[model samples]
Target chain A: MSNIFPEVANKVPRWILFGLTLKVLAIIAGLYYYFTPSYTRAGYQPVQPVSFDHSLHVKQVGLDCRYCHTFVDRSEHSTVPSSNTCMNCHSVVKADSDKLALVRESYQTGESIEWVKIHDTPDYVYFNHAVHVNRGVSCVHCHGQVDEMEEVYHAKSFTMNFCLDCHRNPEEFIRPVDKVYDLQWEPEDPEWEEQAQAFVHDWKVMPPESCSGCHR
Target chain B: MNRIITVVYIFLIILVVSVLGFRGSKSRKEPLYLFPDMDRQARYEPQGENPFFEDKMDDRLPPQNTIARGNALDRAGVFSSGFDATELTDVAFNTGRDEAGEFLKELPIEVNHELMELGRERYDIFCAVCHDETGDGNGAVKNFAPPTLSSANLLTQLYIDQSEGEIYNTISYGKNTMMGYADKLSPKERWAVVLYVRALQRAANATADDIPEAKRGELGL
Candidate 1:
């Protein structure tokens, strides 16, 4: 309080002043980019042929995504559930509703329901649900909080570099099956968790090591 | 004073970290063996010759089954056949007795109505799209082609008379264009479909006399 620097007059140096200004500018730029919600591939809220409430059907009703999107494990394209699957339940459940009308129309009309894929990655990037899920890649790692989404929306910034961040070190991002595609998913027990962590850290998994891991 | 304190703090940190790191490296790994007393302390130990370092320690260990008069741990895991660690088998660690033997020593899957019903449900859910409600390959996907399944001669030989294991194998590993239903159906469900296929075979070949009391009028057989 009373002239702390008694030996030398309290003075700010020129270089120190310049350094402070540069640090402040860097902090400002970093914060701006970090908080910005903008992305390269904008979210696709495309009006699907049937206004499918993924939340109502998948989450609320507990109708498994597998029940509708059957080919997730076996095939390249997780083929849109045929109208027949819809007709299985909707044949009785929502028979009067407009969703059922669209489904029935598809059956009578034999026209395919154009479902706008929510989590669409690039064509070159070969992503398999079976291998990724089986190997420990979380659904939320790619798909975001799908269970909560009323109409599906892209949750994560799906850039190649974004994927490469996880691909580089899979153990950092990948998790068990129950946590996959889940929002508030936590590992059930600590014993299983320790085992899971051991499995991940011990085994080597890298995209660069496995070309088909990404390419195929 | 701050500069001296910082330098002293850093020096202390470096010492602590070096100690911790050296100790940690050893703590992380199992010490395979102590270095052999160099057969008269040598001046230079090069590559494979240098023992008990991180990279070359694997070579320092004596070969499996080698007789050791003094050191006994060197011959550790000799009987394990090249593997230093004991392989953890699921069956051995799990209940000691044969697991399947305890559950269904004899496959208790008796020919029953419930199995047929389950088979029918699975067949309708999976196979009906390509192989119709009847065993005829005239499903919704068939586009009303020449009945691939209706031929009685083929149903008798290809499916009905074949061993249950063979039918199961066919369902597990698909044939031609038919995708394997292993992913879709469980092992029990696959067998169930095999049972349903057999039932369908019966329905196809049965004459009017074979029609049941309740369904005789319904089929007009």
Candidate 2:
């Protein structure tokens, strides 16, 4: 009875094995590339109740980040400005504009504007806005150049590794304390590296690499 | 066999490209979490919704007629040298008034170079948008604001004649069209702004004699 059929029969088994291997590799590659914070969370742009333009307020109008986010330097959570904060200017400026109808209503009714949050961390991560801003970590680092964004969107991956990149070497990112709010500020001096290192040392910006640092 | 393999490879490429698209492309949909893990928990986040409350707000306002606990004046004393234990009992620091219920003529906190610098920084952040960088009425908002909403020029004679405590009260509680910044600025910071405003007033009205003989040359006066 001997050797079954033709030599091509043996090759058919080999071809099927090769195809299986290719299919497995493709699936693994797809998962590795697509399932990451960069792909999933980086570009979330939720619609807010009001179309507040950051570029107009921050870049052109020259409002500081603290003008609206008043508690950023003092509290763990950065306070979203009350509608009263909006009315502080809008009540005088665009008092009758249809665009600001929601804002005017919120101010009058003493109701909170349901502004959708963009940059959110996992529940376990205890990130403090005060500690970062006070330690020379500019808002531009994590939030990106919000002064340029007309409608704010997530600009960076807030994954554990993304955070670790700065924590491991804060000298690469931290700027002068005075320049933290100035997003346009760039280190023009050739000795910026040395200056950043000095700031890291002086500020004692030893961000923890251990789990407890953020998790707890 | 070769033809079949080629077809399979092409199919895989199309599948990956179509499914993955491109990273960082804008999306209105919520992020899809594969594992989810504990990305969100059953805890109340700041500014989050709570159906348990009648207002459906997790953050509750402080009850009416309740003053914050602790020595509010004493807390401000930590930042300045002028306040003593005797002044802790006095409501002057918080209210910007004296025992006579009149705005104090001088700052409750001691004025120093550091306080002045802080004042300048805070004023630029909080006030310069409306009050202008040089304490002039013309600021970025002046273009949009009507005459009724125009910010007061701190350098004007009206502001110069005002007492330090009166200026502090204005900064804290706001005047006319301006809104109160009591929630935004601490008592110590309000005092610092008052000092900076006084400096601006003096600079605006300075005669050649007002400048120091040594510093006059710096200005090419």
For each candidate in turn, the TM-score is: 0.43, 0.93
True contacts kept of each: 0.00, 0.76
Residue A209 accuracy (lDDT) in model 2: 96
lDDT tens per residue, model 2, A1-216: 787778778788888898889888888887777888888888999888899999999866799999999889888998899888998888789899999999999888877788999998889899999999999999999999999999999999887899999999999999998888998999999999999999899889999999999999
Off by over 4 Å in 2: B65-89, B147-149
The 10-residue segment of model 2 chain B with minimum total lDDT is B70-79
Q: Candidate 1 local accuracy as lDDT?
A: 0.55
**Residues B54-108 of candidate 2: C-alpha lDDT, one tens digit per residue:** 8888888777866567545456635465645544555788788988999999888
Query: Could you tell me the lDDT of residue A129 within candidate 2?
Result: 92
Interface RMSD of each: 23.3, 1.1
- List ranges where model 1 is wrong by over 4 Å: A1-38, A177-184, A191-193, A201-213, B1-189, B192-221
Local lDDT at A204 for model 2: 92
